[model samples]
Target: MENKNLIQKSIDTVRVLAADAVQKANSGHPGTPMSLAPLGHVLWSQVMHYNPENPDWANRDRFVLSCGHACMLQYSFLHLTGYKITLDDIKNFRQLHSITPGHPEYGMTPGIEVTTGPLGQGFANGVGMGIAQQYMAARYNKKDYSIFDYKIYTICSDGDLMEGVTAEAASLAGHLGLGNLIYFYDSNQITIEGGTDLAFDEDVSKRFESYGWHVQNLPDINDLDALSEAIKNAQQETGKPSLIKVRSHIGYGSPNKENTAEAHGSPLGKDEIRLVKEKFGFDPDKDFDISSEVSNFYLEAGRKSAENEQKWNELYENYKRAYPELATEYENIISGKFSEEWKEKLPVFDDEKPVATRKASGKVLNAIAEYLPQLVGGSADLSPSTNTVLEAFESFSPKNRDGRNFHFGIREHAMGAVLNGMVLSKYLIPYGATFLIFSDYMRPPLRLASIMKIRQIMVFTHDSIGLGEDGTTHQPVEQLIGLRSVPNMTVIRPADANETAHAWHVAIEHTDGPVALALTRQELPVIDQKKFASAENLEKGAYILSDSEGQPDVILMASGSEVQLILKAQEELKKNNISARVVSMPSWNLFDQQNDEYKEKVFPKAIRTRLAVEAGSTIGWMKYTTDGGDVIGIDRFGESAPADELFKEFGFTVENVVKKATALVSGNK
Candidate 1:
């Protein structure tokens, strides 16, 4: 039997290390870490199937601290458990260039599952991981060889549960019956405010129960035995996800701050730390002290985890020998390598017919889905409108985890977070769809995805004011600019059906960061590749669709549906004996990555008179438009009218474009 005193000492070591890290940084939240340390110890040492030496083990249990303000707890565990994280790294917490940041970032730290600071994002991310685990197990696991049975464990706080995204994710998780998922709600009764009762007074356990989750309420956070038993029970209850409502005190051992709001965010002062350390039987005078016994215990745990991975490796070898093709596919997926033939599967659009870019996107998705089995996603209850449904696949539900299509209901916020979670699996490429205007609802996760640099594709249809009749509330006037403002987020607005197909190609290949595809609901005439530049140039981000003879007098550039208007205006300009070049500028982020020479080649410095037309805000056009240039864009909300009528009323006609281009060309602005 394990010595109870040693376990207690190890738990205390975790707590003291977390507190000391915060004390050293003089920033960050300490209370939740102090309270949740026992739980962390129990999971990492006894329960979790993680090899610290190989943090990327495919079958390892995922631990997401949804309340990322308490990142010290994770860092403490990483350091003690013989991960790459060192005591020096913990000492350098929140400092520049340190592995330990203010919050846990996925790739920046060895053991962090996802980057999370915003409340409820990590909670939903865990749900996505659970879904991925379920789907993968169903797809590859034979009856005798259960390859993918890892559980996703998340420790969330009152703040995380209070966020609306968490509610949406919880509802979906319960509905899907993700039994591989287990979340520990740290019911500390305290927020940054005085108490959770100040703003949150609902019965959390009852709420989760209503969502069809297996709810277990434990009144003590320090009860390792109870926590372990609850986890085992959760693992056994394979019909539903589990929520263990752990009633923990904020700053568990602090002499004066326990259970108080003061302990929630700021570090406990040195005097308080000394008292807490003394209370916990540690050297009050020392900082960041870890006992040899606790270190050896965690190291042994890591060794056992490595042994578990070795066994899995052996099984993988056997399975590979038995099932060569499936094993090869699994290896390729985990390594983020796709067959070269998948690129050939990208659809080629017909120029004879007009099609909505969203429709084109749907077609492209299906065409490549056969070759790229890693691609899986759904729309946010707007599949019919967004055209994101995969007609060939069954919906991902409780009954069939092997299905590729996911029905995200109307929860765009949770969908975003869940997509991030799925992508974290390193084998799944997840996308979520909604109207471009509703991107505001999922902005937190979108930003987080970019920050984490995860491979997530967000399909946004009804991209602009052109999504008419729905009026201003549904129209996205500034959404494009808002998306562009996010660093590492590639926002692609295709000009036509063919460009839409190529845009998907770029998104699939561009795995360094997140990509947002803004597609139109209105049908646009497909640009004939024979007459203009080939649609393959879409990879360059901005390309000359149709160029004038020699030095052009004016450059007419636009993106999305407005590119057609620019093309029409080019003909009108030529009728008046003026040379105008039409450029399709799809993605500013991708274009910016191009060298100055390429950018200059597309928009020559000599072409001073330039006009940009788009159906959204004119904020970002100045970068391309020179001194004598101007932008034709809608700055105000759209009216409830037919899309054609609204375009004409808002000066988005060929006549308006011609007039604007004429003025710029003639220096008559």
Candidate 2:
């Protein structure tokens, strides 16, 4: 490896800058940045096409730090290449809200594409970016007019490959033939505890090759020419994703800490950092020093991207004339604006008979699927069961990139992460579905989506123990409570067909955070909107479906399948001279956000005799039930029985609800 050159000097600056920031903060992983600076320099300077002036450029190449503990490497380069991050900002790394946190946060930092910290999440996100780019190109690009021709480049670590989520995403990317993905596996062979051999010794190259990726292994990270050629070869291979495994020392310049776990985490002391600066031919005393030549070089790199963006803008103007309709649609999608015409397409299910909420959801999805070209998704091999298939379009495949529906196979974890990736730009409305029991497999991505506040739709069917005959293992006794507990996650369990339609409408239009539609497997009778409150009230989370004349002795509240039970109980209570109001509480989070006035209107303080019913956990219902109220929910696991028998066994019958309501009212008396 050449020790003295301008390129080497620029790489050294990145390394030193990262270490100095970590040392100043007395925290963060320092070894990864020190070893990976050469690769970062290559991508930001010569390889990738992105404009620091406008990081949100739609056509720009994306860079994801899958090995997110090495976030300082990205931060240092972001400052050097001028992305609104100044030298002082880098100096304030990991401090209180200084834009440089412990890990890369998506909107908190300008150039960051996604929030990454948990290993393999960013890897899956990069695969999603590749999928999104291919679909966008297939739908929007024309001959000699590449509207969306960008690659998703990523740098992952040994730990990333070890995660199960990475395997799921990698297999999908390979099967899709995502040629736009180029991942560099940083093989330092060192984990926090010790060497990779303690637990991992399998041939990763052979494994990735089996997954159908274009594989290349570089003997040394110092061999810059070899790394460049591998990237070039990866770009040329338009049939598969590429992985280049590069072996490098964890702590490159540190004399004692190099190739050791001591360097992976913890900041180098002042003496060690000063020694590194001296080795890189910088002033040993100057902590955050950068040579003027290197600074000018990266600043020039930033300016050149603006020229590229200028050309893209010019191309887009011409494209508008050539294809007016597509250009307009593209503008609308990019701006996060949608026509209200789709709202008209929402179905009215009152005329229909009893039907499963999942079945009704399928109809509502297909009704407006044509209106929004950006609305596309599939299931985790549960499309038939979850009813998430788009009837009008073909499934997206290696051969059919323009297809709207995605066959994400049986990978729930990857599907959730992929949806997060696709929806990050606000241009694509992506969704993924599976049985409610399997949402446990998707917790990481679900939490990440909420943390990022991105719009992702998760359709979870077979909700509650009512999905019977499959036993307790298949039943989701507490999944609803689990999803409801997550912040920024709106969990809606529609009562019937009409509420299901409204739920889909709200999901499609929601821009703040992810929404989970917990649909039932059993058929539920549609509530007549003409006789009761309009089904459109489902958007408000909780609504009065059926009410007593003026004042009520007791209130019956429920969600999803249990709403029908409460409705029946309301009629039964009325027959007994006990006036009970029926409240369809579809979403607790949404109702919680409502003003006190709205909440009081539904669950008034005067009416303390309230009876709540649901087939999931009873933990969260107590807040709404209050001291004078009672709730009927399955706190224990369910048994293998028919849906009707299970409901009877679990005390979800209308007779049981009537008994509970009468008892609550009598107890208040």
Clash pairs for candidate 1: none
Q: TM-scores of the models, in the given order?
A: 0.98, 0.98
Residue lDDT tens for model 2, 1-669: 233488899999988998899999999999999999989988888788889989998889999999899999999888889899988899899999799999999889999999999999999999989989998899889998998889999999999999999999999999999999999999999999989999999999999999999999998998888888999999999999999999999989998788999899988888899889889898988888888888988998888866788999999898999999999998898786888878899989756788999999999999999999999999999999999999999989999998999988999999999899998755889999999999999999999999999999999999988888999999999999999999999999999999999999889888778999999899988888889899889999999999999799998899999998988888898999999899999999889989999999999988888889999999989898889998999999999999989999999999999998898888888
lDDT of 2: 0.92
Local distance difference test, candidate 1: 0.91
Lowest summed lDDT window (length 10), candidate 1? 660-669
Question: What is the C-alpha local distance difference test score of each model?
Answer: 0.91, 0.92
Worst 10-residue lDDT window for candidate 2 reads 1-10
lDDT of 1 by residue, 1-669 (tens): 268988998888888888888889999888989899889988888889999889999999999999999999999888888899989999999999999999999899999999999999999999999999988998889867888999999999999999999999999999999999889999999988799899899999999999999999999988888999999999999999999999998898999999999998898999999999999999988998888888898888888877889999998888888878988999998887889887888888764589999999999998888888888999899988888878888889999998999998999999999999999889898888999999999899999999988889999999988888999999999999999999999999999999999999989888888999999999989888888998888888899999999789899999999999999999998999989999999998988899999988999987789999999999989999977799999899899998999999999999999998888777743
Task: State the displacement of the C-alpha of residue 424, model 2, in Å, after optimal TM-score superposition.
Answer: 1.8
